[model samples]
Target: MHNATSRELNVDVAIIGAGPAGLTAGYLLTKAGKSVAIIEKDETYVGGISRTVEHEGYRFDIGGHRFFSKSAAVVDLWNEILPDDFIQRPRMSRIYYEGKFYSYPLRAFEALSNLGILRSTACMASYLWYKAFPIKTVKSFEDWTTNQFGQKLYSIFFKTYTEKVWGMPCDEMSADWAAQRIKGLSLWSAVTDGLKRSLGLNKKPNDGMETKTLLETFRYPRQGPGMMWEAARDKIVATGKGQVIMGYGLEQLAADGEGGWRMSATNKDGDKVVVKAGHAISSAPMRELGARLHPLPETSWNGSNLKYRDFLTVALMVEGEDLFPDNWIYIHDSKVQVGRVQNFRSWSPEMIPDEKMACVGLEYFCFEGDGLWDMADADLVDLATTEMKTLGLLDPAKVKGGAVVRQEKAYPVYDEDYAANVAAMRGELEHKYQTLHLVGRNGMHRYNNQDHAMMTAMLTVENILAGERVYDIWCVNEDAEYHEAGDEGAEKALPAREQVSEDQAAALNSMRDVPERIVEADADETAADRRVA
Candidate 1:
C-alpha cells in the first residue's frame, strides 16, 4: 500500500492545492525570500477550474473566467505575474430563451417584441397581480423573483437557467441569494432604463455608481487564464526557494512536535513526499483537509458536513464560422440540459488554433456521481451536439470533434447549515493550529472569484510573515475589495472584533454570495397542504 522510498523537503511554508490561492501565496512567500513548497493534486494543470484545456491544438477554458476586480492590489498582482500577456477584450453576454437572444439588462422594446403580444400582456398582468397581492413573506428564490419580476417573467427568464446552475428548484432555494445577486435592480428600473436607451436619452458615463454586474470589458491573457498560473509557477521555481510538486496530494497533516507541521503527500506512483514547515497554508476543500488532519479538532465534523457542487464542460469543435459574438450565452430554454455555452474565439482569437474551426464549451452543473457526471465522454459530446442543434445554435453535420472536462467541487454549496458549520470548523482550527491557515474558495467554503481567493492568500502570507494575524482576511468581500485598505505589504492591523459597527462586523463575518438551498418542511404533507398551512 505504500512505497518504500520517500523524499523530504524543509520549507518555511507548505501550501496545498496549486490553485490561484495556493500559487499566489507560494509566489508571494518565495518573493519574500522564504522557503516554500506547493503541492497540487492535478499533474497537468495549475489553475484548477480556471485552467485552459487543449485538445487537437484547440484551447478552451473550463468555465469562462473574466479578469476583472475592484481591488487595486489584485489587478496589480495580475499584471505583475504575467505583465505582457494581458489583453483587453470587450465583454458581451446574453440570455437565450425560446428562439430569441435578449440583452442581459433587458432592453424594453426588444424584450417586449421578442415575447409576442399575448405573452407580453400576460407577463404585464402577472406583474400587476403580484404587485397588488404580493407574498407577505418572501422566503425562497421563487417568491422573491416572482414578487420582483412577476411569475410569468421569472418562469421564462430565471427559472430554468437558475435551476440548472444550482441543481435545485427555485422554491427550494433561499431568497437571500436572490436578494444579494439581483440587488439594486427591479422590473420598473429595468423598464425605465430600457425605455431611455430606446429613446436615445440614457447617455451616462459609468462613474463606479453603475451596477457592477454590467461590465463592458475585461482583461484576459492572450493564451488563456492558465497562462497566468503557468507564469506564476515558473517564477516561483526561478526563485530557487520554492518548489511546486504536482501529482502529489496531501495525505496527512500532523504536528511536528516543535510547533510546526509535518505534511505528507503521495503521488499516483505511491511515492511519498514529506514537507516539514513552520507554517501551512491549505487551499484544499475543508472536508478533505479535516479528514487528513491527525488528532482532528473537536469540530472537524462540521468541516465534513460542508458540501460542494461539481461542474463539467463539454467542448465541441465545429467545422464552421464562429457561432455568436458573445463570449458566452446563458441557455434559459428548459428543453435542453445545458446551462451555458462559451465561445473560445470570442474570448480570444489565440485560443483557437484553426480559424476555420470553431470551439464552444457546453457547461453542465451536476453532482459527482449523477448521471450527467457519469455519462461517457462521447455521450456527453453527443448530448452537447444535440442540445446545440435543438437550440438552433449548431449544425450537427459541421461538428468535427469534441472533448469533455469534469471538475469536482467546482462550487462550494451554501446550504442552511453551511455558515454555522464553517464558523465552528474555522473557530476550532484557528484556536488549535495557530500556524495553519485556510485560504481560497474551498478552504473557506466560500463561493469566491479568483481575485477574492488571491486576496485571502495574500493576507495569509502577510500573517505568516508577521508571525501573527494582523489582517482579518475574512473581511475580503465578494466584490474582491477588502473592507479595510492598506499599502502593499504594509502591516496595518485590522480593527478588533468589538471595535467595528454591527453592520461592519456582519459584513466581515459574511461569506461570499452564493445561493443556498432552502430546507423543506413536512415531507408528509402535500404541496397544497403545505402552502395552505
Candidate 2:
C-alpha cells in the first residue's frame, strides 16, 4: 500500500541502517565535510541492538552493552561524542545453576562450596587429565573449551548457557566463536584470580594480563547507549549531513550506471523515498542486503546461507526496592527458556525512576518466527514471570508490569562453514562493488562488540575519503591493532602491548606475530588537506 510519490535525494554517500556503524561513518564523513544520507528501518531508536528501551519511567538495554574497548580510537570517539553521560559501572554477574548463584570469575571459595569437595576434586582431576592428554585437533566449541577449562568445567559452566544462546549443541558450533569470545582465559588463570580476590588483593594483576571477559569494571551511558547514538545523530545533522531518515526500509538497491547507486526505501506511512548517491555504506544484515540488490551479486548465495539468531527481552517491572546486586545473571538451567536475566537497577540506578520499583530484563535467544518469537507479548511476559518465580529470583505476584522488545538478526551465527561463506561474500562484494562497503555485526556477518562495529565504520569512512582501501577493515578483531596511545596521540600512534604474564606470553606464542601497523600521517599536511578539501 506504499503508493505515495517517490521523492528523490542525491548525496555523496547513502548508508543503510542507522546503527552504531552507520552513524559512526555518517558522523565522521560529515565532520570531514562529506554529505551523507542514513536510512534506518527502525521507526524509533538510533542504536540497533545497542539502543536503550524506555517504558514508563524505567529504562533497559536490549543486551547489556559495556563501553569497554581495547582500541584507543574507539574509546576516544566515545568520549568526544558523549563525554558527560558515561558512568563507571562495577562489573558484577553470576551464573545461576541448580537454584544457586555462582559468582562469575569463580569466587574460589564460593565455587568450591557450590560444587562441594568431592565434585571440586573431580573437576581438578579432570582438568589435569585433559591437560596431560589434550585434544590434538580442536574442531568444535566443545573441543576447544574442554581443552581450556576441562570437560567437567566446560559442561558445568559453559555448555548450558552457550547452548541456550546459540540454540545448538556445543559440538556442532564453530570453535572460532569460542576462541574469539573466550580467548586468553583458562581454568588456571581463573583460579589464580579467584585466589587473589579471596585474599582481598583486588588490584589488577601485577603482570597486567587479563582476559576481556574478566574485566572488573566497565563504562555505561547514564541513560543508556542510545544517548551516545542520539548525540551522534544530532551532531551529524548539525554538520549538514542528510537527516537520518528513520522507518525507511530499503526495498531495492541498484547501480545507477554512473559509478553511483540508486536506492528505493519504504516509509511507515506507505511512502517511498528514492535516494541516489555516489557511495554507499551498509550495516544491514548481509541476507537482507542481498535480497534488496537488483540482479543480486554472486555474494548473495553465501549471504543467504549465513545464519542468524534472533533475540527478545522481556522487561518485568517488579515491586521491590532492592533486588540482586549483579548487573546480570546467566541462566545455566536447562529447564528455563530464558538464557539470561539483566538487573537494570544495577546497570544504572537512574534506570528505574521509582525507588520502590526495580526492572529486570529476561533475555531469551530464539530464531525469528519460532514459537517463542511468535508468542504474544502478554504470553511471553507471563512466561518470563513464571520462569523468574520458578528460579526463585523474584515473586511472580510482585511483577507489576512488563514490556517486550524483539530484535531480529540479533546475533550472526558461527556455524561450521560460516567462515568460508563469509569469506566468499566479502571477496565478491569487495571485487564487484568498489564503493559498496559493509560494516557492523550483521553487516559483515561478524559477531563483534559495538566498539568493533564503530571501528569498522571509522575505517570505512577513511577509505571513502581517500578514494581507496587505506585500512583493512577485517583486521579489527581480538588480536587486531590496539593502540594504547593517550587521548591526543590516539589518531597517530600505535603502541606496544603491556607486559604480559608468563601464561599470557605462552598463549601469544601459539598465535602468529601481529603485523606492525604502518600509517604515515603528516598532521600539518592533513590539517591543510582538510581545509583544501
Candidate 3:
C-alpha cells in the first residue's frame, strides 16, 4: 500500500529514535549482519535529551549526563564508540538553600555547620525520634525519607527540591522510588563518614564500591554525549547494512499481514518515507506508539493514559572566569524557579570554546505547553540572567549572550496508575506483536538512567537474534542500582523468559517511581484556595 510519491526501504529491522537505546540496537544489529534503518525526527542532533547543543562556538549539555554505569557492557560500549575522547573529571555538586551551599550526599559535618547548632540539634532529635518510631508502613517518598533522615533534615534538604523537579508533593510519590534513588547511605552512616573524613582517617579511594551519589569522579566525552551517538551513526553507516534516516518522524506503524512491520514516517517538508522490516524496535514514548499503531492492540487505551514531564535549558554565556568549580548546583532555594545550574567548563574544558569566557546552563522542569515551555527565547534568557544574579552566582553585566533549548517528554511521570497502565500495555503488546520490542526511557515509560536504557536494548537484540525471548529486558537493571565496580557486562546476565517466575516478573515489571498527583480532594481544596486568594 505504498503511494507513488513515497519512497520505501526494506530491511531486516527498523529502529525508532536515535538515542542511546535506539542507536545501540541499530549498531549491534548491523554488526551482526542484520539490515536496519534507524529513524530520527531531529534533523541535526542524534542524542535525545543527552545531546549537546552548540551556539556561537559554545556547547551546552541538556541535563549534564555523567558517563557512569554499573553495567560493564554499557561502559565498554561507551569506550568503544568514543575511545580517545573520554576524560576523567572530578565530580562536584552541591545543594544551594537559603543563600548557603551544602555538600551533596548530606555530608554530616558540612550540613550541620551550615545549618547552625540549634537546627542541627533539632535535626538530630528528629532523626532519633523517627528512628525510635519509624513509619511502620511506608507508602510515600516523604515517609521513606523521613524514616531514613529525620523529619527536620528531610524537610530542609529533600522536600522543596524534589517537589520542584517532579511538580508534585512528596507524599504522593511512591516510596519505592526513594529506596532506589537514595539507597545505601543514612543519617547514621553519613555522620560516621563525616567524622572519619574530618579526622583524616577515611583515606580510601573511590573503588566504584561507594554509594552512587557519593562517587567523587566520572568519565565524560571531550565534547559532549552527542559525540558518542554521532560516532555510532557513522559506524552504522560504514557497515553499509544500516542507515540512519534523520528528519523523519514516525507517522504510522502497521503489520504488513505477513508477520512483518510496515512503518510510515514523514519529514518536516511533508514528504513521506516507508520502511518494511521483519522486526521493529521502538524507543518512542509509549503513549505516542499507542496512538500511531494501525489496528491498535487491546490495551492501547492504557498506554494513552501514560503521562510525561518535560524540561528546558537556558544556556548563558558570561565574560569572566567560571562561576564555580562544581559541575552543577542543585537549587533547593524555593524562591527561584531554576532547579539546577550546570557549569559547562566543569564538565569538560572543550565544551567551552574560550577559556576567558564561561557558559552555564540553567535547567527548568515544566510540563509541555506550560508557561515556561511557551516563553519566548529572549525572555527566557533574561529570566535566567536575573536568577543567576539573584543566586549570587553571576553578574548580569558580565553576561554576553544566551540561548534556550526545550526538550519534550524528558521524563516519564510515575503516577499511582502508571504501573497498572504499563503492565496492561506490555501484556497485550508482547502477546499480540512478538516482533515489536520496546526499549529506552520513554519507550517503556521507565525513569531509568542511560545505562539501564542501553541494557534494555542490548537484551532485546539478543532476543531478536535468538528468534525467541531469550532474555527478559524488563528485568535488566531491576532496582536501578548504580554500582561503580564490575567487569564489562559482568552482571548483565538477565533472566530468560521461561526462567522468570510469575511473582518475580510481576515485581520486575513494577514501574520505577516518580511524582504523582495529589488526591482529588486535596487538589480541589488547593484550587479553591487559589480562587479565593
Candidate 4:
C-alpha cells in the first residue's frame, strides 16, 4: 500500500476525475494559462464514461453516446479539440412502446398509427380529454408525462423503459426528472411540428432546431465519445496549462492552511504523490466524496440520505450485416435482464474491420455487488448474446467474439429520499470548501446524459474562473424543485447565472416563456444544490 513517487508535482488547480467535466475544465484552465493537473484513479483509461475500449479486433463503448446539445459553446469546444474527426450523423431513436417500436420524439402520425387505429384513437381521445381537464396534482415523473400526453400514452411510451432506466417505478420517481429532460417538449408542440412537416413549413435548419421534427443529425467523434475527451486532454496538456495524470486515485485531502488545498493521490504505477493547489474541481460522486473527506464521516449514511445504482456492459462482436437500422436497440422484453443494446458497428463501419462483422454493447442495470456484476466476463457475454438472439437483434450462430465491462455508479438513482439528503450534504461541502466544485454525472449524482455532463463540466470551470463561486452547479438533473421556504440567496445568485451563458437573454426567454420549463433554471443545477434546501 506504500505507493510513492519522486516526481513531486503540484499545480494551481487540481482537477479530480478525467470525465467530460474534468477534461473540459482542465482544458479551459490550461487554455487560460492556469497551471492545472488532472488526477484520475484509473491508469488504463483517460475517458471516464465516454471512454472507448478495444477488445481483440473489435471496439465498443459502454453506450454509444451521441454528441448533440443546445449548448453550442460546448459543441464548438468539442470540435476544436477533435476538429476534422467530428462528423454530422443522423440520429434515429425510438421507444419500445406497447410491444412495438415508436418514434422517440413521438411523431404525431407514426406514433398514433403505431398504437393501432383503435388504441390510437382512444389515446387521442384521452389526450383531448386531458387537455380539457389537465393534471391538477401532477407530482412524480409518470404523473407529469401522463398529464402532458395522457395516461394511455404515458403507459405506452413512458412507463416500462423509463422504469428500466431508473430501476424505480415511474410512479415513485420525481416529476422534476421528467420536467428537466423533456422541459420544452409538449404534445401540442409535437402536433404543430408534424403539421408543419407535412406542409413543408417546418422551421428551417439554421433557425435553431437541428432537425426538430426529424432529429436529422448529431455530431459524433470518429472513434467514439471518448475521442472528444482524449482530444481535449491532449490540447490542454500540450498547452502546458494542464496535466492529465491517469491512474491516480485521491488518497487524502487536507487544507494547506494558507487558503489552498493539499491533495494526495495514488497512481496506477504504484506511485503516490501529494499535490498542492490554489483551488479544486471534482467530477467524482458525492456519496463517495462524503467519506473521502479529510476526516471520515462518523457513520455510513443510512438509506434516507443517499442512494445510487450501477450498470454493466457486455460488448458483443457478431459476424453479421447491419443488426438493425438503428445505431442501438432497446430490449423491451421484461424477460431480458439487459436494458439496452448499442451497435457501435452501426456508428461507423470503419470502427470495425468489415461490413461482414459487427460489434454491440448490451447494457444491464445492476448494483455494485449485484449478481449481474458478479458473473464472469464470458458468462455475461454469453447471457447478452442469448438475450440479443431472443430479441432477434443478434443471431447466436454468427457471434464472433464478446467482452464485458461493468461500470459502477453509471447512473445516480432519483428516489424520493434522495432530494433532501443530497441538498444538506452539498450545502455543507460548498460552505466548507470555497474552491471545491462538484460537477459531471457522478460528480453531483444526478441522472445526466453525456451532453449535460459535459455542459455541467464547462459551466463549473467557467463559474469558478469567472469568480462566481456561489453558482448553483447542482441543478443539472431532470427532477429539480423549489425546496426553499424563503428566498434569501435566490435573490443573490443572479450574477452567477448571468455569467454562465453569453446568450443570457435567450436562456431567460426560453426558460421563462415555456410553461414546462418554469423551474428550468434551478433544474439545471446539481442535485446537491436543489436538495440542500
Listed per model in order, the count of residue pairs whose N, CA or C atoms clash below 3 Å is 0, 0, 3, 18
lDDT (Cα, tens digit) per residue for candidate 2, span 355-392:
89989999999999999999999999999999988888
lDDT of 2: 0.78
Q: Pick the candidate with the highest TM-score.
A: 1
User: Local distance difference test, per candidate?
Assistant: 0.83, 0.78, 0.82, 0.67
Q: Which ten residues in a row have the lowest lDDT in candidate 3?
A: 524-533
Model 4 lDDT tens row, 1-533: 65456466678887889998888888878888789888888776777878887777666776677665444565567667888887766666555543577655445556776768798778878888777776665556776787778877777666766667666677666676677656444565665566677688885312211234444566677777777877888898789767888878887766666767877787656677777888888887777676666654333333235666778889877786766667776655666777777778667665686667777788888877878879999899889888877776667988888888777777666554565666766776676667777888777777666655665666676676777653455544332211101221122222245453433322211221101112223455543442212
Cα RMSD to the true fold for all candidates: 4.4, 11.8, 5.4, 8.8
- List of clashing residue pairs for candidate 3: 72-488, 72-489, 73-489
lDDT of 1 by residue, 49-154 (tens): 7888888888988788888655556777898999999898888889898889987654544566689989988887888888887766677899888888788988
Q: Residue-wise lDDT of candidate 3 within 1-533, one digit each (tens)?
A: 54336799999999999998999999889999999999999999998888888999898888988887655567778888888888989888888887788876556556776888899889989999888878765667888898888899888888888988988888777776787777445567656666677789887532212445356788899898889989999999999999999999999999888878999999877788899999999999989998898878775356767888888999999999998899999998777899999999999999988899999999999999899999999999999999988888888999999999999999888776888888988898898888999999989988877877887898889889999887777775343434333333444344445765452343233344455644344433442342212
Query: Candidate order by TM-score, highest to lowest?
Result: 1, 3, 2, 4
- Candidate 1 vs candidate 3, lDDT winner: 1
Clashes of 2: 0
Best by lDDT: 1
